[model samples]
Target: MIVTHEIPAIQTVDFTANTTYGDFRDDLVRDGYAVIKGAVSKEKAAHYVDRYHDYLEGFGLGYDRNDPSTVKEELLPVINEKGMLFHYSAIHEDFVWGMRAEPGVLKVFETIYDTEDLLVSFDAINVSFPNRKDITPNVPWPHQDQDPERPGFRCVQGLLNLLPNGDDDGGLLVLPGAHNISVEFHEQFKDEEQLYRWTNETYFFTDAGMKWLDTKGFKWVKVNADPGDLIIFLVEG
Candidate 1:
């Protein structure tokens, strides 16, 4: 039931504007995901991108930002097939922390929770490259990060795009409004065997589940964002 289709148009918002904060909130509630335009200035994003390259090249493993051949797994950090660099303390890097502390990034969560006091998750940075001949194709693992036992908007996930994410650029693909029916779906599949048993935080959808979503008229959408834009979505969605 892996539905392959053309990417949808970009959905943009202005979370930086006080006037559109409510509109952004409403969109997240209804659509399960929203992209905040220019969450960080283009210049800042480019700087962060440079920092990422520096971090990679700092390994001295022969990785070169200018050479694609140097992107060999043996010459780089332990990046997963999905191009997520979770090892080498990448999450605690200064550039990552700087992005987390960005005013625009913090304001969105503050407005959502109605509080300035908040904690952030040290998530992995994705550097997915297309048409790589060195490794297997990156497969899309469609799953909800929310545990069904304790569901209903437990957390919101944000992806700060440091690169140009066009319709063709591989990024996040979300099932719109599927969060509204998550509870029902989980209840129906409670007795089914879990694919990822090591962690209760992630629940991968089965083919039957995809069929169910299709029956409900839900379609997967590829979220597009420019450099410095932040795409936020519900963990339960």
Candidate 2:
């Protein structure tokens, strides 16, 4: 069967700090990623879900059964048992813009990365399920947010939880301090073509390649946090 992906493309949000920017930046530096509890008001988080559905209604943009664009190309998403999305981020223009320019969200990055000139890479809205057994795990591997040539403080990714993240929900997991490690192994997975992996480790390289992660003492775990929390981590420069 032939497969295709039809999805709208847009940039991730770039926010400026209006409050709690200073405190959060420190947390980001200490931990690879920090979960900001209720980063957005319940009303705002709800907006994300609303805007998500709107994007679907307006553009007919959900993952087509025949075509895998929504999951493969957009976020490598895996639907959970409850029939809900684990990571879905095909957003409308309003949602993207408002999130990018979020004052509270951006403030933290500006201070920690120590640059007013921070930019966000386009990322997918993800939803990971708790206890969803991945016989073939497809976790998002450790990599910088920006391109290999320029991976670091200048470019970062922001993940904000619009919903509740209890123990049941498999929160995001980042390898602590793996940001400072070398990108040499990342070279193999560098190809933008490495998108679909329905079987193999969704986020792992070859054995030779994965050996690199072990060298640096890679640590992977769910990014635990309540709703309205956001996490920003630094990439290598």
Candidate 3:
């Protein structure tokens, strides 16, 4: 049987006033991040997470690549049922599209980007595993999300926390103001392999070797939040 979820329609988040707008902007500018407390509503987030649990139970979970890939649209994860990958977007488009209209998200983006004409897109389920330690650090080997030769503008990344998160539980760890640094910095780090230094310069030069080089020159902050809490991080353009 194709399982179903009980999640209600996610309402449009409203930021109809300057005060509300400024509050979000300030938070983003000052912290390079903003949190929408209770953005998803615990009951709502759980409906989806429960589906993930059921799907994982029947089929299972596996990491697709840099991040885990579920069927992006429905929030269904690719489980590891005996060593196979799957993807499901069982999540509602409203939950995905409505994030753009989310008042908390809009305000923060407006404040940081200084543009009222902002649009946010739900990227993926971004299931942060249980406990804070179950998460991975956001450090990139160098432009992890984009190609090395072609520097692309970073669209803001919004994460829906489907579970409780803490510093110990694997919440996001962001590098403050690192977004403001030149892309050249990332490229430079990309070429240099720290492993080579430790191995007496015996690091073989290969695309795979550099893949493990993960470091960002900036202060990294861990944003702790609950299931309903959402995070918005403004990147280059």
Candidate 4:
């Protein structure tokens, strides 16, 4: 059975507004997530999408933007079970780097870190295709990216949307206000064996942790964004 949870709607910050930075920071502190609308121009985002398809088609492994049938695993680079493309040097691509260096994108990080000297994280690009019988369905993995040992905020995760991501379109789902109690949650489940053993930077919440979130009335929110928009969220302690 597919279990569904009700998520509350959230207002995204307007990037062009001069007063939204404070609101964005406030959202991060209170809700654990914030969205900046039109961080990059829509036209530029469309170009980025085209470039992304170019990268895939350049592989010459039968992947084609116009043909959905060609999106098989054999034709594409290594994509994780969650539809994340971290391999095939996707991180080093020029377009990806360009998106990272956008002024609006950098300003958000600068506002959070309070300095211009910032280093970007080598993150993955997500390419989720719906109703694909050729690929495995993405499993929902609820977890915090923060290491338990590091109690306070260390880093914020950001995603630049290249396409319209609405409710039906799969995107980020975050537990609202979960970051406030992340430290306590980790301490409570300190003895539980981690689900993901590859890295300490990620702490996968167990069934008990989900129950804990429930008790706190923290509901999962499906964060939506348009092309050229940026979504930023804390690592949840």
Candidate 5:
């Protein structure tokens, strides 16, 4: 059975209004993630959402935002389960890259790393329609995109919120300060080769990882953000 989670207080930083690099850095160091408020304008975010919708339309999934008659019910499971329409290659596409190179976004990263030179990651975007009775939404399991054995601040991950996230809409959940003890977690699981099949394997917290999260006071902090808000976080195991 799927377990329910209690909502925890999440930290937010206003990138467009008043937050500085120091504030961003400190919060990131403390909570392992920072929600940058208004990292992009609502208008810009809407445009990207439109592009994503167009991609879906072209996917030939028979998905019609307006009409249920056009939706291919047979394809719902495939898309919901495998996310076949969610393509990382969209990073090369205009709309996705536009957000990646967004001046405000790049500025934040530049400030955090103390460097102007940086490489943009080609990441995939998820398009989950709200209040959809047809498709079962993808429930995110707690996991880190970094390897546990390798501690300390390494590469950062970016998620540009093209749509408003919270409640039934779905959002990101973070385990605050989990980074500090990630190395120890790795040491304990080092012998489990299949678990760490890759150097930067995304460590999904099942029973063992959940125990650590619980004991360490690492609650599932929901990250809520508006369209155009970018969530940037340090890579932690």
Candidate 6:
């Protein structure tokens, strides 16, 4: 498949003590994604990065965060029985859950829902390493994290960047304003043999689905964020 990606410039908002709820929600609703800058402290981000390496060592992978020499790219992606995710280790699990329950993060979601009641997703961390000569490029498969039964922005997906990402970095890609028509898009593909479905790991879009989204003017926007930043996107049906 000849896959091409468009990397459009994205705007990020710095979260301050005075940042308003509207600032976050407007970006999310209009762009289908929002980048919250400095959501975590630099010191904390450094700690998490170090902790990740320790977790990998504990899992027998023996990866050194600061030393690339320790990694065998092909033998990578060590996982536990609980599912091979970054947060699979007990240590990472606690760190990830703690991030989810952060007061600032919760406040943003609560304000969007206009209710104090909110549910946090048990999400796993995603780690994509550079491709080796023997490995194929891990291309982006644009898709919505939703099923036809559920419509509108029923759920939100988030990513907390532990490292800085550049334009060429393999990261989350999105289609701005696509969520606004998610219901209609799903209706168009209700009979598809394999409609995009949400999973704990990832979601996917079929060729037909991609073509349809393209026809509707949906284009991919690669996400770029610095350490301590957070990116959230709406998962509409």
Q: Between the candidate structures 5 and 6, which one is better when assessed by TM-score?
A: 5
The lDDT leader among the candidates is: 1
Ranking by TM-score: 1, 4, 5, 6, 2, 3
Q: Against the true structure, what is every candidate's RMSD?
A: 8.5, 10.5, 13.0, 8.8, 8.9, 9.3
Candidate 5, superposed: residue stretches over 4 Å from native: 1-21, 68-88, 131-137, 192-200
What is the C-alpha local distance difference test score of each model? 0.83, 0.53, 0.49, 0.80, 0.68, 0.65
Model 5 residue 133 lDDT score: 57
Clashing pairs in 5: none
lDDT of 5 at 195: 48
Candidate order by lDDT, decreasing, is: 1, 4, 5, 6, 2, 3
Top model by TM-score, which number? 1
Decoy 6 TM-score against native? 0.76
- Per-residue alpha-carbon lDDT of candidate 1 for residues 26-124, written as tens digits (9 for 90 to 100): 678678898999989999999999998998899899999999888788888888789888877789988889999999999888877778999888768
When 3 and 6 are scored with lDDT, the better candidate is: 6
TM-score: model 1 vs. ground truth: 0.89
How displaced is residue 11 in candidate 5, in Å?
A: 23
Model 3 lDDT per residue over 1-237, tens place: 979543432123222223444554456545556787887678877775666455444433442323444433233344232212324553344444554465654665564445797654433444434322222334333223332333333345667666777777545666565544435555555556544333221223344433322343355577888877878765431
Listed per model in order, the count of residue pairs whose N, CA or C atoms clash below 3 Å is 0, 19, 18, 0, 0, 0
The residue pairs found clashing in candidate 1 are: none
Question: Residues 1-237, candidate 2, lDDT per residue (tens digit)?
Answer: 969553331223223223344655545554555566655677887777677555544545454433433443233334444334434454436786687666767766665556688766553555443343432455445434344444334445667777776665655566666655435545645654544555321333455545657775675666766556776654441
Candidate 4: 10-residue stretch with minimal lDDT: 8-17
TM-score of 4: 0.88
